[model samples]
Target: MTTKVRETQICLVVFIGLPGSGKTTLCRLLLEFLRTSCKSLSDILHHTISICYDELIPADKFRYQDESSQWKQARRGIVNYVKSLVFTLKDIEVLNMVNSLEVAVREELLKVVQNEKKTRVYIIVDDNMYYRSMRYEYYQLAKLYSFSFCQIFVQCSVSDALNRNSSREQSTAVPEEIITRMAERLEPPDRQNNPWEIFSLTVPSEKWTVAEIKKISLFLNNAAEHPVVMPERNNEMCQESRRICSTNVIHRVDIMLRKLVGDRMRERSQTSVQRDDLQELSKAFTDLRHHILEGIRTGTIIIPEDTYEAINLDQSNCGHRLQDFLNGLLTIS
Candidate 1:
């Protein structure tokens, strides 16, 4: 009897930080550390590629809302290029797809692909992924491909980042304002909140030590060994879950509105309000509640489902809106 061996899986390491946070430098040090220090990892690792957004996106396209679509396309293209490289281990098709990339980037990619053997690979994506949504995109990609995903948050203060930016080459350096803005918006991995980001590490850019490198290598090794398992998809179950959630939200809102309407009716009754007017007010309130509930069910009204606090805040706002409607009805009566 022959023993069957499991093949090594690909790992995608996403770097999240602000500009001048030393993500690119860290990438270099990590690759070198893995290649030299971790002999076991180096043996199975066919190639380690670093994909820097600075090389892929133009300077003018940075930190601008207007260029978001372009940024998205570029990021998607990079992922596609990586997928092509992994599946085909060839750069010809990848190059044709990303011909807009810098010639130097193209050459480097070609060089790496040419040297790659049939073995496991690690891809480090270097970017100032300041938003959780930005990192989630890569996470989704990893989940789709059943690949191991990990995030490295390069921690650096705004002042330190700005200082580092000042010392860089004029052409390569980012503006101080962009770095500051990105730092303000940076959402570091919260493993507790996001289960997908459980395999995450945070490293101080100013304190790079052998111990830190070892820790990073260990983290990567663990992540690579345990690739993300794709969840079983059940459309019927998903639809049922959504229906139940929607029903619950509508029920809560209806109860709140009924209480508000009852209170308003009692207040009007104490003031000798007309019976017809009271009935009309009740009907109006019922209609408005129905409209609001419908909007929630259809997602026409935005409700934050991620946290109870957000839902409470939204409910408070809804209560205020309903109160205003009651006030308007009273004035009309």
Candidate 2:
């Protein structure tokens, strides 16, 4: 008599924190623990894959301000790659361009797809996802694919992060300013506000221990066993999901507008623009941003069905609108 093979389970484990918060260290430890613990289960196979954005994207690409679009493209590529892996490995070109480590992981994933054994696949995404929008992307992906989704926030004090960063090698160490900025902007998972982030875990890095690995493993196992379920159309859950998406889009747009305003102020200051005039320009941009956000929140501004596309579209439109307003002001001045 042949034993029945259990269905394959897939989970997307996202790590969010500031750089030097021990996210990478915790990921390594968790993967090691999972692999070792799975050794005794003959009928079960556990496959853990680590996808580090730092490894996938070149470090220098992040230095230029204008490269934000490219950064988004790289992020989109990672999401697409994960989608392809979860559904079907049809993007061979993407597979070809990835590094050797990712290539090996893909090969293993392919085996799991072909094999008859009961397998549990865990894809750990290692990155400093300081924005809630960033984590929401993976949550959406998990919901779309009916895969388990969980976030691990490796919390560390700014002082601790700085000390740890200082101890690192020159090439590997992140700049102090960058770490400080990230810590300030870091939006750790809030399960109360964001219902979708309920599966998240916040681990204080300083208090982390070998015992924590067992706890993490158990959490991951539970997540895998219960994947995200897609909400029915026109239901309260669906409406709430839309609200969350809109909130994320608004937050992202707010960040973009602030950056644009700051950049413009800096440029005008260096071009002999009067101090009063610069203040006026800043005020105009701030007011316009507030108006735009209010319109979005009040349902006066209709967001597109595709939230991601809406973000880029709205951002471009806002930039042009802001520039037009600036041009009018310059002409009047």
Candidate 3:
């Protein structure tokens, strides 16, 4: 006799671990299982949107040296921006799923609902979610969307991860130094801090047997039993998180702008400066400040006009470039 597992309704499964910890492998395995074992067509498709951070990196970035502070800042900022965007996209994707499901149910064409039960939306966000703040971002999104969120921590010893990295192809293998640093910094998920972690899975260092993988597949299929409690739309914590992110981004930009002005002043031979340059700089800063405030209010990020041109004027400028940065951050490339 075969046992049937209840399906999830609007769920997100995030893979968190250091690079080379088999996160991608685990994600692929689970994805295949979900697609094959689905009870219906809608369940098979599941409105699944798989987002992997590694694939989002632009080809030009591969040539960038990691030694510069400006580069490092840009990299981190871009990562944070992408993280925020992922959360935003999740809301949109869920809404789309709802619309699609509604149409499917109305048309009465497919038995997406077997035995009068509906299929669910599923998302897989694959990345090295190393920090608690990263997980918290998703937690907030899950609460807002009324989706069951699960964190799958693909755990492996530092040595095992390093060994795996070493064996990977040149195009895919992560740098050993980066792997070591991330291993040192990873924050494993805990159920104590957030109830969402209750549905979390921890894959061990050893390879998962087929039976074990099947068990995981069943576990996820039956996740609807652990329904998530959606928080109020005007939750104070969400507002606070938005405030903090906006403030940090504003502060960083302000510091860089100030340094740019200082560098220009030092380059001037005479005591008097070009009023035009000063006015342009001032206008740029003001526009950036206003746009940032707006972005915070609207839950998006912005790049002030000509900000990139100004930064690029000084070949050695330490200021973060805005155009390519924004494109990369928003995954326009």
**Order of quality (lDDT):** 2, 1, 3
Q: What is the TM-score of each candidate against the true structure?
A: 0.63, 0.68, 0.54
lDDT at 164, model 2: 90
Give one digit per residue, the lDDT tens place, for model 2 in 236-303.
Answer: 87565554545666777576656766776786688777889778877877787676667656655434
Clashes of each: 0, 0, 0
lDDT string for model 1 (1-333, tens) is 212222535788899887777888888899888766654444564446677777776766433331244656666667676666545332234444435444544554454445433345677888887767667667666776787889999998898888888999998888777777777777788777556788999988875787888888888888887777765537987645444445545665567667766776676677666889778877876777677667657655433333222244464444433333222222221
**Residue 124 CA error for candidate 2 (Å)?**
0.3
Assess each prediction's global lDDT (C-alpha) against the native: 0.65, 0.70, 0.56
Q: Compared with the true structure, what per-residue lDDT tens digits does model 3 show for residues 185-268?
A: 777876653344678888785676778778876666666445567434397876565444445455555565455445544544
lDDT of 2 at 82: 77
- State how far residue 89 of model 1 sits from its true place (Å): 6.4
**Pairs clashing in candidate 2?**
none
